[model samples]
Target: MSTLIGKTALVTGASRGIGRAIAARLAAEGALVAVHYGSNKAAADETVAAIQAAGGRAFAVGADFGTEGDIDALLTGLDAGLGGTGLDILVNNAALAGGTDLENSTPDYFDRMFAVNVKAPFFLIQRLLPNMRDGGRVINVSSGVTRIALPETVYAMTKGAVETMSRNLANSYATGKRGITVNTVAPGPVDTGHPMFQIPEVVEGTAKATALDRMGEPEDIAAAVAFLASDDARWITGNTVDATGGMFLGPRF
Candidate 1:
């Protein structure tokens, strides 16, 4: 974990769930973390306090990622937080989830989904890359839904786009002198306090869906992102690391 000492990381949606876990993990590794949140200042503050309590450095930044001028606002906050330091890790973990099937999906809903899940990360990276130091890392948080059939067609499509972007960006940005690493971590059936998990049946079904016979925790996904963000993963790029607990490994039979 000391490998990240003196490095700096930015994690979007770090107010809760997997993003929160990732921020904590990175901070534990000795990186100064900038925790980004959409509209939850209290949650974001809590995250920062927790990191500091654990002998780590962290700060919270707020910006509604799907709205107009979102990238500008995020950069404004991040610049203030970072001072003159360059970014060493960028985690695109914020996204809009939960969309209906094609028949029920609306144009507005679809656009919003893309705005946060796809467009936001795309432009955010475009703006952040200038500040990212050589040998930095870009980690996109995708979903297992992209590899399996799901009712949330719009949401799945958005993740698919992120996976593609991860590959393409790794190729385009990770040049000889740059050495940047870009990758995606796709998690499956994570227990993130979503309302849908309140139902006992849904919980049971999700647990059984994985070959491990247990739903994933936010730390599970965070561990994967931590690896990709570290110097140990210098050779690994343009890849999707499946953090799905063997979900969709094949029929149960």
Candidate 2:
């Protein structure tokens, strides 16, 4: 945890749920965090306030993601926040989770989800990498559903892109033992504040599927993200950490 002292992190979609938890965790571990939200200013500000109250440094920033001006300003502000310390970590945690089966999914659904979940992370990293400190970290959020062949092909495809990017970026970055690592964090059925699926039957069924008798919490995923960002995980690049509660053990249905 102390490994991140004096560093800075830019975490996207950090207004609530998983993204917010990750931002707070990073801050608690001593990184000055920039909480990036797409439109939820209130939730983003609350995350920043919580971090500061915990004696950690944080700032809130909003970017529509994929818009030229927003991305540009986000990178600029991220660079400035480092104050010459350099951007030490980037958590591409923002995503649009929607349900659509192969039989009825629309192209528009695919486009919007890909733009946010895949395209945004791809370009955001490209724009921010130059300002990043050497031997820094990048973590992209994937999902255990990819393994389960979940209903949302568009969303899963985007996350697969994230996993591939983790490998490719690790190869391109991390020169000469400077100790940078890039990895994917995939969580399964973590409570992301969307309780539409939180019915007793669903919860009970999900719990029965896991060795642990319950679904995952956002902090469960956040803790894994924190580890990948830490020096303790320097040699763990190009890998995907499965934070699922044994939920992807077999088929979905």
Candidate 1 global TM-score: 0.96
The whole-model lDDT of each prediction reads 0.92, 0.84
- Report the Cα lDDT for residue 212, model 2: 73
Q: Poorest 10 consecutive residues of model 2 by lDDT?
A: 172-181
Poorest lDDT segment (10 consecutive residues) of candidate 1: 168-177
Per-candidate TM vs. native? 0.96, 0.92
Once fitted onto the true fold, the runs of candidate 1 whose alpha carbons sit more than 4 angstroms away are 173-176
lDDT per residue for candidate 1 within 1-253, as digits (tens), equals 5769999999999999999999999999999999999999999999999999999999999999888889999999988899989999999999987759989999999989999999999998888887689999999999999898889999999999999999999888333259888999999888899888878999888878889888899999999999999888999999999999998788998
Local lDDT at 85 for model 1 = 93
